[model samples]
Target: MTNTAQPPQQPEIPDVLSEKKLRYVDIGINLGDPIFRGVYHEKQAHDDDFHDVVQRAVEAGCEKMMVTGSDLKESEHAVQIAVENPGLCYATVGVHPCSAKQFDTHAGGPAALLSALEDLAIRAKASGHAVAFGEIGLDYDRLFLTPKEPQLKYFEAQLDLAVKVQLPLFLHSRAASEDFERLLGARLPELPKRGLVHSFTGTIEEMQRLVALGLDIGVNGCSMKSEDNLAVVKEIPLERLQIETDGPWCEIRPSHASAKFLAGAPPMPKAVKKEKWAKGLMVKGRNEPATIPLVAHVIAKVKGVPVEEVAEAAYNNSIRMFGLGSMENASS
Candidate 1:
């Protein structure tokens, strides 16, 4: 009988580094969203546009990114993208609170929906590219999309699933702090230690509670919307903070008008540069992973830390939380 033994596989090559260049990790980006389609020079191929976005992000010093998965279909696509890109990208697998209706009994029932999500999570984990389980949590602001009861039900289920899978979380919360806090607080001991409250727009008191719970806070354009939000941002400890784009959605508020904020803004990548972008289909201020530096810049100014310091801290936090092994080798 012939032996069919195969040799051990070598790890993928890490991003080439320049000693002077700072590396950043966007802990969240919805790259699979259709909003990005045709935004890059009216490109017809989504794969090409996606690659362009990744390349530009790398060039802009965003060395790594976590593609968010709001539902099972998006989660599958996210994992595939992460697998295809290897070192540059990772994925989160979960259902968003707004889409809680999909898991409702009236729709397809929680058992079927959750079973599908669990399978996707297992497959994603096996791929060596999935980092967390989320875009999951409560979103009372969009209760019209899904009522409160089902949203709570699904959030609890996903939390339990995260514990089962032993992965970190990429969480969301908006205008639903009471129930969000209560549900999450009940499961605090059961959930993974390294979870993020992505795109946090909560009050300082709420932020403090989450921090006390040992969860990291994700700051994006929405988090910097007003003086009230800026005040909340200022109160967040540097050690507990991470930055994200939440792209094709949250761009830095134009109303900020601070020279420091404007100065820190990253320029548009040449890959996506075009005189005219697709109307209506594309957002007026389309955020992308390449703009992570800009988010970092805003964070630095708000935190009163150097931009490089903010970048390094966020990068370090992301790698530590997500267990991104490739970056450990690259950083060393």
Candidate 2:
């Protein structure tokens, strides 16, 4: 809840990249145990399933992938992937609220969530490449398992950890954006000016509020389907935006271009046709880092900038926000 660091004046990063020079840095991808194809569905498949799919993602455009793990075990797996993959992969450690439903304990359930986060925090600090605190926030929509309190507890704990470690955060908030805002209203995490609220599906008011609090928004393919968000992109200065595919999970279907994919995933072409908030494909459950460029294309169209410029800005913004600039190997 202390004052977050103020962001510096925006740098003049080039706005576009040539077709062959396109390099994507996906801020979100889940290539672990539960590969969770696309945006929402958890992978219930076998252990060997994601290797080929992830290889495809790597071959596509994902230069540096930040994988999000929903719980303790999954987080461990995500970290392992980053370790094995070296400079090509990165992971964030935190308990995603929706998946922590059974995490209650006696003597203040909040303590239990905090305790779990402590472990992730330690692991994250040790894993030099695990750069952020993520997929952490409230979800009023998924009320069946986790109630508001536990969700809030996990979110606050992760936020505090992020502040303590000087890492940025990748946040997730559904219908609870307001609640998320209330929790972070005056209490912005004391992070270097790089924290972001991922896949922002909230209203303009909520977007404005988060921006006011010194946080940026993660632009996934789903944001392209919403009129509100499109307007948000048109209005909210691009300086507050960053690209995220939320891959191996929320990829928008109908590949933006004919970049034939070699990865295996559930074919849910209808998902993108819905044209509502989800667009079925992107938010359905089968996303990967290879889908980053496609998402970036849509973001460029919405902002009326060349795809090259949008990609470059998003990449540079991500570097500046997550402290990747200091890492000698953190470059395209």
Candidate 3:
């Protein structure tokens, strides 16, 4: 007698597992930050040092990225990088609150600084490489960087510039929520509807207030610091959330670590070995845009949603908030 048995059926794939690899858009990255320079090994004379980082990011599924502009010079550099890379990158043009003092010290003082920023915004926008106006807002946490008064003054000036340029705002706020809320709230009616609070580490109440005002929330390592923070993350509405690496800083929080998140992350290029990282830190100490998927993974775990869902919502939300046209256009 001959007997035959069918092979045991394979387990069905979960919808999340069946989906394609999650493509991402980093809504914020300081690609021009000095820390990024020489992070990779020295290359040949003809090599484009920065382009290597961009290539690695794309390979890791971050198809598009918005290089943050924290000041006038950095904003110019960010725009230049974006222009050089075209569809793969874009920029925000504004002075950070920390750099607010530049306004007073600039050649013709605050008026000249404001005029120059306006000129940059106008030029950056015309290049089809500028997506917003910021990295701007109040940051009392780093008061040493800029006194509260200057922070507020320049923040207000940049808000006015954002209004004039009609670009979405890439806002920053820390430890000065009361003042931040008051100032931004007063101007809410005049600001564009598409702005976001980047690196948001605020309370649920604060997050709610921002969402209520039609602003999206940008999450990164800094935003996931504690159980309380993760709890707040769970409360954020999917459509109102976006993920960023905020690289060279804000790697995923230690408490929220998971190998699963890093599974999709791109490996450090051979040119940059683990031993080369800055002292007293792991290889991840220098965060890169490629780690964005890890950010999505942490969000998925905290919110009890599929990673794919987090990735899709974030990718789409970024495109919508930044008016990145279409994924095809933005990622081309």
Candidate 4:
């Protein structure tokens, strides 16, 4: 096991505050987790665990969280959270192609996953709450479970489902940009309602494809170290951008090595609640939705906008992209 040396903690925020007052959304959060790699290792996401984190986020200036649910059950859980939380949270339902590789009890594996995904989509639509079809796309880099071909197979299948449902698509393209672009190219006519590419860390050409496809780019901890990502972000307009913590699995850190150390602890359940910034050099242990104000802080420095303005713009873009009604209703 890694040295469970607790990383430093962040300051708490006042209760009677609205991040809407500033203007940002930590839109992409994995409130329910299986503890994947990268920025999501601080919180132990078993089945349904989020109240504490949600409270922290509200205080930290993040008024909205568009959680990702990669399968039927997770999607249902996300919807439950949305319904329970009312406006602070919303959800996207889809079978992430990578996770879809595990679809079982079927004559054809890939086909089974697609069928299952379609069923989930139907349920979400029937529930009348699913905002988008997401956490679905290509990932040819990590050889975590199955091979690449199966992932590609179901990715297209889900893309087809998105078109059929006429819902926005929230995608995750990792080390499979060209393949992703080719598949997306074929789905162009229905691309206007396209979704965002979570935790974007690809090349300029890939970024171009994202922009061309009308998809939004999500920035998180890994983005902290990439000048290339910042360069791409600089070129991409704010409307085409978004932010996420992807927590309880991938803990975004101020630096890389630190991120690695916290790469296995369930996303920190929550930081303490209060109303002041800690003095001195800030050390990080876990990443949460609330930690996003710091992300907005950085983006503001780069985009040359007031931190509050960036927060609000990102917040509105998130609501607009995800079809989540309004930020005020969300955060309130």
Specify the highest-lDDT model's number.
3
Q: All candidates' lDDT scores?
A: 0.76, 0.63, 0.77, 0.64
lDDT winner between 3 and 4, please give it.
3
Which of the two, 2 or 3, has more TM-score? 3
Candidate 4, residue 133: CA error in Å? 0.8
Best by TM-score: 1
For residues 260-300, what per-residue lDDT tens digits would candidate 2 score against the true structure?
22133212123232124221122234565656777766666
How would you encode candidate 1's per-residue C-alpha lDDT over 217-289 as one tens digit per residue? 9998888888888888888888888998898778776675322465735555332333343221123466777
From the highest TM-score down, the ranking of the candidates is 1, 3, 4, 2
Q: Candidate 1 or 4, higher lDDT?
A: 1
For model 1, the superposed segments whose C-alpha errors exceed 4 Å read: 1-20, 39-48, 105-108, 257-260, 264-266, 270-284, 327-332
* Tens digit of per-residue lDDT, candidate 3, span 158-225: 88788888888999989888888888887768765559999998999999998998899999988887
**In each prediction, how many residue pairs overlap at the backbone (N, C-alpha, C within less than 3 A)?**
0, 29, 0, 23
Which segments of model 4 are wrong by more than 4 Å? Answer: 1-21, 34-49, 104-112, 126-128, 249-252, 256-284, 327-332
Task: State TM-scores per candidate.
Answer: 0.84, 0.75, 0.84, 0.76
